[model samples]
Target chain A: MSVLTQIKQAPAANPIERLLLATEADMAKVNALILSRADSHVEMVPELARYLIESGGKRLRPMLTVAAAQLFANGTGTAVNFAAAVEFMHNATLLHDDVVDESDMRRGKPAARMVWGNKASILVGDFLLGQAFMMMVETGNIGALGVLSSASAVMAEGEVFQLAKTGDLTTTAADYAEVIRAKTAVLFQAACEVGAMSGGADDAGRKALAQYGLELGNAFQLVDDVLDYGGQSGTLGKNVGDDLREGKMTLPVILALAEASSEDRETITAALGDAEATADQVAAVVAIMERHNTLARTMEQAQAHARSAKAALEALPGSEMRSLLSEVVEFSVVRAY
Target chain B: MSVLTQIKQAPAANPIERLLLATEADMAKVNALILSRADSHVEMVPELARYLIESGGKRLRPMLTVAAAQLFANGTGTAVNFAAAVEFMHNATLLHDDVVDESDMRRGKPAARMVWGNKASILVGDFLLGQAFMMMVETGNIGALGVLSSASAVMAEGEVFQLAKTGDLTTTAADYAEVIRAKTAVLFQAACEVGAMSGGADDAGRKALAQYGLELGNAFQLVDDVLDYGGQSGTLGKNVGDDLREGKMTLPVILALAEASSEDRETITAALGDAEATADQVAAVVAIMERHNTLARTMEQAQAHARSAKAALEALPGSEMRSLLSEVVEFSVVRAY
Candidate 1:
């Protein structure tokens, strides 16, 4: 039986899983391409690379690329390459982000930087990025290349900006928005847009997919920020309060700080960036979040963006792929609940 | 007076200096493009970028790009963009290299990672690389882009290989050759090849330039390895015995190991990667190198590559630019003496 048939015969799958199942065949090709391209005669390059790439994250970004391409019937098979490139790009960022943040764990395992030294992590990340560009160039699509390249620059900027904001209580919600949009949303936008381009998307179709991806990405990050404080470690693949310890001023944090009483504000200010922050400190911060309804408010914002993501599908013709993409956006925010 | 006239009036400006003078006007434009593109409203990106970019080193790789393009009269101005891109690629590597090596000094000053921290260095390096690819795509030259993108992958592989070989006493001359070729020569090859492409070079012209750059790059790195032992800190922009302390099995070390007496071999191996290795230890290692004439032998190898670099230029038509390129090869090896 085909992979899709096998997936269908299994127990009920959620919307995102259903979307993934719908594109499993194409995504399998993408995975193979990623594996082949990630290889090097340099033993450590592939060893460290596979340690992260094969870690069981949802592969949501590449799946978006494939599903977006599936929205049109005119794909020229280049989407497989683009999808793999997107995954490489994402994994590259994760590798570097772990080093920059001094993160010990990723996807519930020791980070690549932890397993390998920081030197190997940095070089392997560079290798993956280099491979990503190679894949993009092989597509022979200059437009897609431009989109991905610009996203890379913007993402780096976002990261640097975030680093600069670390531990600064003055970081505003607008600043947080710019961070998420640049660091996270731009890649999603580029991935879906490139997929559409590979599928021979016209200007309108491409713009529609870009908008859809951007809104969905915003919603996804917003919920991710909420989960850092509200969800279990197993569900989040990381410790609770990681964002707080990293001094990342996510929307919920920004909102709580804005409305916090001086005592509660001091509590957060003391705990922010404290590596030794205890569980009680996290609970205290969550208590402040609850007092301001900041977590729920952030989820409400995510739901709004999710609505906008689904609304972007109106620009494209009605199709099963479009419906699946819309459903995936809703599922992204609903995970927070 | 113009830079060219000043260079001509000097009693004995080196061939490489003369080439820089010949291309001064074009390279100035390329420098401006680099500075402008390196900027970001995010602040730290530009701050860390300029810290390294403005650090005074001869912008040799970018100059090679411009000079190579100057060989042909039928040039589009795309070489300026390519030159800037080449410089960005080199700077990006330097930023990451400092982090990988835990280097404190670069170009006779504190490394960017020292001033801005490793996080900023890595992110800004990524920014520079992203900008480099953007410039390449802006040229709309897919072939040039392919050359650069592939060189990037090879360079990363070379770095990872070097990292793996760290402190490995079994590292062969052949392994060292591959390291330098991948880490250094490939960029030089791509820069010149793309310049030739921008100059509308025929296949033979492109191949000739590629060979010239590869041989010259090999010579350049061989001399660099030798300088770590023989040159002063001021001249080398780093302390003497840095390669030894870093456990890099460069050419001179490889040669010494091959011919050393058991006692001498043990002495050298003990000092390898020894951060606390004393002045006497370094002197002892140098004594072994002198006895075996390994340093001079390494220079002889550099001279051989330099000769080959000049020979490659013979494939091109006679022109002042071609002659200047040939002379620059001679100068690269002479720097060792």
Candidate 2:
């Protein structure tokens, strides 16, 4: 009896957990669709795609899509297709990013590029993108397709823009904000917007959800910035400080640079983008960031974005799904805290 | 008088020129659309995209799209978008292919990867793909979008499949044919098929154009295979024997392996995929292929496919565009002769 109860009563203690519990059945279908679509006659495609997809992602973006549809309380059944398509787009972007960033690990495993080589990783990303569009076309929802497609182009521009600004100490907070919006928030925005459209959302509802996603995405990115500088736990993991090593001008760095002493700036610049920088070098940079309290300021800004995200939820009717969506945004922003 | 005549009478000397002459005004718009859509606020995106787009290869795929659309008298003008989209798709594939093949040159210039780095080339490729889909969505022709999207996926599959069989000595003739069809032919098939669809080709016309494209694509790739092995001029140019060096299981190699002596096989195997394979080594392999007469056999197959391509055009009523298409097919296959 105890074993049966334990198996049946999965914990929903946190907001994401609760959200997951609420959308478990829907996500199961979404998972099935993702797996089926990821299948290909070419053996390496599925092998690489699966290794990445099944590697420990929380499936946050697709869940937002499904939850958005559920919040609308109606759907044309295209929501499932949109949800799966959104996930594919996300995964495709990750595969490309792995190559673009020369990332050796993803979600705590060897990146697909490591397993299959860069060429395979890239071509599989393209294949998944094709499969994504095919699924969207199958829905015959051209409006939603347009939104997602436009978001995709915009997202690429964001990445390129960020690439241009890498290691620029003069990069302002505004620049980081724009990059985060374009490269990070826009995908989240498109996922929710399209999900709402597929779920029969009217103009106002779609706009509100779009705003919600964009703000949530910004908050999500800023918090990630904080985590890279030693989050609320104040412990540096191996993966920590990767952005700095990559010479990325994230919010924490931008905020810290605004007031950094020349000597501190030198310390930061030397370690920045040095592939072989020692851990002590990174920790020294972290110490400067701490002295400036930039991580805390970044967290405050994240909380503000998170608040705006929840405020956007007021535009929609109150429902169990709506609260879960709001809480998920809250859960995401406070994660570093 | 000479200058005026040179400017005025841009001679339509070849079948492709005739097609170009026939579709000049439409292709002008297609070119306009191509340039406009390739424009991105991201500086590197347009810089890299234009470099590849402006390279000296004739705009063959987009021209095919324009010609196919013109073949049908009726049209909704979405063919311009489809043509531009097709070109972007082609360019995007080339950008990706540049990285995948690790080739040093494309259309006689340093590959885009060499100029901007592989990451930029790949991201720009993804950006172009996104732009392609956005243009297609703007047209609201789901059918054409579906065709192009599926082709994109199939083309990637063909590439992956080809990569898998790169050095397999036991690869069959059938495998080579399928790879060429998937990797090379489907884009051509999709180009013409989508064009005919946009142009309002009736069912029979559409089917005929599709068949024509598939066979023509096969011919085109076969000719390319022959060209890689000393082409029509019979001189071992700098680029000759590239396919053998890359260990590509193209038709010439496939057919030659079927009849090679053990000693000849040893020579071919030693040079296959050897990046540092010398002129002497490649010349020795070419000598083996010549004795086996595989290049000629490959050209014969190309001619057969070309004949089949021209025959498919017989289903349509004779017209200037139709004749131009037929001639283009003939002109494509006999390039090596």
Candidate 3:
């Protein structure tokens, strides 16, 4: 049987995992490029950089870039470069985020900052970002470069906005939407947009990919945020209620706060930003979210984004890659189930 | 008298100050661009960014970019954008550096971290860097973008290397050279090279400007290092002996360590990395540096680089700007006197 026929017959495998298998060949090249680019004559740079990059998170962002590129067969090998650049940008942000959040663990391992110290993390993060831009410049595509650079600026702005809103009960759901869009969705939009551009996709294909990626990124983050309060630590690779402890105003909390009674609101506000909050406090906060049906509503919101993500794919001609990307968005939101 | 003759006849005006005056009209546009680009809907970003960018330092790096571009009369107006980008890059580094060093003062003011906090400083620094790259992308000069991006990587590497060498008495002079070159000289080289490119410089003119900027940057940093030990706190915009307390292995310190008696070596090492080192300890270290004439040797080294910087100008056709650039190199080192 042909590979497509066999893929169709594969009944039980998750779409994301299947998509990963489908794009594994191109992704290997991106992975190799990432490893080579992360290297430096300075020993600590590569050492600290690999410590985070090699950590076994799903390489979802780069995979999206690769998969989006593969939606068209006109690849000129620029997608490999863009995929690697996207990964570098993501890793750089992780390094800085750990320092900013004082995170002790990532991907079920000691965070890079925890191992290398905050100073090394900060400088090495800068190094990775510089390398990301270098790879983008090598592509000689000015339009793609403009897209990526704007995403970069918006991501920083999103991060700053999130920092500004931390622990503020007055933060609106609109503000939360803006935060997730800036912090997470913008890069997704840029990645898929540039991927399609590299794949020789015309304007319609690129716009479709961009909209699809943005909605998928929104769904991905909302599910991840819900998981922070409800998923297992082993599955999440982080402690439960980390967002609450860090005072991150995620959607479920925002929704819960808006609907909760004064007593329940007091329960959350007390635990918010309190690093010393006990397990019982976290349980109480989760219970309030449950009482308000916020987690379920958050999952519904994520599902809505996932549906939009799939809807955006209508702009592109039907292909197995496109169908698989559509299913991946469903799989992302369904995880909260 | 003509403007060139008038400039030559001007009595004892600092060449850097004179260059700034010469480029005032163009630089005003660059300054305005910097302010406008730094703005954001996220208010803290613009606030913290301006707090650093508007802080009155020499604006020396941007001035070099503008003057180098002015060497060719065929300016395309891109130099204004490049100049602003260079300033943003410089200011971004300063924000992150202050956080990494836990510094208390910058430009004779409390460091941004002290006023705004490290998290804000870090995120705002990222914002400025993003803005810097955006401005570069707007220029649509991929080659110049490559130059700036590579310099950014090298600067981060230099900072990491410096961190590695901190308090290591065994650090060689070659290592010190590598650190300062990466940290300081590369940006200067890139600034002038891109400026010349924007100004429509020929290959020889670009190469000459790059060499001149590199050597002048070497001389400038050497003088700055010497001043850290010998200049007043009011003049240096930082406490005297701050480098010693931080255990920086600068040129004079390296030289002094090499030639000191064992007793004097003990005094220097004891004070190294001792954040609370007494004024008497700093004086003793300086006294040893004087006994070994290390400060004088460092000044001699600066003078040598300054001369090489001037010699590099021989490749370019002589113009008032070229003459003023050569004089700026001399004036950089003369500050030591």
Candidate 4:
């Protein structure tokens, strides 16, 4: 049977095991390529890069690159290169975003900007972004370069959109989704879709994989917003109510604020919209979220996205890899970390 | 005659003319390709993007891309695309640099950061950089992509190197040159060489054009640094003494300090190194520069680079375009604005 036929058959019984074997298995090789493990500022940029990658965060994007390539051809090394490229782009965004937000912490550690000054952080981000394009060129895969460039453009647009909305309290769920998709899901989709392009997935297969990844990314972000609202509670590296404190209007808060009574809306807005919001005020906003059932509603929306993401994979030939991808949808909403 | 032969033999009074024509003629088409040129924040980003293209800052780098392509083969219209790509990259860096330096004016107007907040300035700079790569891919020129990507890596590395030396009084001319190459010259070299590549220039022609651009760029930035030390006397858009106030270690000061006696050196260091150097103190440091003839010395260096740049262009046969390129070497050291 063809490689495409092979990737499509038999969803795996154990999702995490497949995720580990398919994605994380090549970490050593990627580390060697980055030569970042031995860097002095490893704690600064390189560490942050690794933390974002290895902090048990899903490697779905890179896996998509791997799987996409596999659909057309098979090479352990080629797959690893594409995977690393996706991750490099992802980390670059995180670095810049932290500076843009004046964020002091990310994934529960002082952010790169906070630990290193903004200049170092910003320049390092640029360096990594440059390095990512270099890697794509090294691939000599024009198609892959196209995919990465498009994804990066979407990411930058998302960032600009987010900047446009900063401190504005009227952001809608649709607008929020637009931001998330531009900033987050576009890269995810591009990651998976590019895999197909690189791997030799036919148009139909590439389209399917891209759709699956985009939906999955949306689901992942939606749940991430939910968790920020006090859902799973004890995830290490998780900062509770950060979006609220930053006055960022995420999906849950937007929905909740719309549904809230005038008085509660006033209170929530008063607390969250202020950049100088106190912890007590932040806690009070969460209480209002509970009263308005915004958190529950957000979870419902998350589940719906998760279901759609899984459904995208259903038509693909069921392989252990596909099953693991399906399990990623569950993990998106289920895991605390 | 073939494109290479044509480039070699054509005699134009101004070397920059052909490049200027390529970019200037393409402006309408370039403007059309940009999204949301009339959006509310268009004044912020799209407007800046347009201002950048229209502002008539030396189109030297873009010209290099064009010249490089023409040297290699028939450029078709791909040279135009690569030209736009390099310009976008150059403009993005300029926007960000102004912000990082807290520079108040550029091209004779308030810098983008001064008009917009630092946050907006930075994000918009990022948007343009992303747009540049997008433009590159749209050109369907993978070689151009490789050239520009490597240039960006060098550009970023140069920025990091400069950041490392900021406020340090002991930086050498060699150290400064390394920074200038990374920060300013690589893109210039890439621009010319990429043009040659697009034009299907043979390897030797491509190499020659790259060297020409490198020397030309080095010449341009050296004069720029001299201008920072009152090289222009009065025609610059912004105040001349600002760099010293910001503790920026430019060439004039580097040379001046190197020759200062211990007492003068100590005074210069103490005055310039202060986070809040008084205007008088800044002026005092300028006086030290005058006493040491550092500015004149730096100007001599700039003139030497101009000669070198002109020499490099001689490798190409005499053409009107080549002559114009040579004129740019003179203009780099002599332009009033």
| Per-model RMSD to reference | 2.0, 3.8, 1.8, 4.3
Could you give candidate 4's per-residue lDDT for residues A47-70 as a string of tens digits? 545554454545556766775565
Superior candidate under lDDT, 3 versus 4: 3
* For candidate 2, the TM-score of chain A alone relative to the native chain A: 0.94
**Weakest lDDT window of 10 consecutive positions for candidate 4 chain B:** B34-43
What TM-score, to 2 decimals, does candidate 1 have?
A: 0.97
Report, for every candidate in turn, its global Cα lDDT versus the true structure.
0.90, 0.85, 0.88, 0.70
Model 3 docking grade: high
Worst 10 residues of 1 chain A by lDDT: A2-11
lDDT of 3 at B23: 81
For every model in order, the TM-score on chain A comes to 0.96, 0.94, 0.97, 0.86
TM-scores of all predicted structures: 0.97, 0.95, 0.97, 0.89
**What would you estimate as the lDDT of candidate 1?**
0.90
Which of candidates 1 and 3 is the stronger one according to DockQ? 1
Ranking by TM-score: 3, 1, 2, 4
Question: Higher-DockQ candidate among 2 and 3?
Answer: 3
Q: Write the per-residue lDDT of candidate 3 for residues A132-168, one digit (tens) a residue.
A: 9999999998899889888888998999999999999
* CA deviation > 4 Å runs, candidate 2: A1-12, A232-238, B1-12, B232-238
Single out the weakest 10-residue window by summed lDDT for candidate 3 chain A. Answer: A1-10
Model 3 TM: 0.97
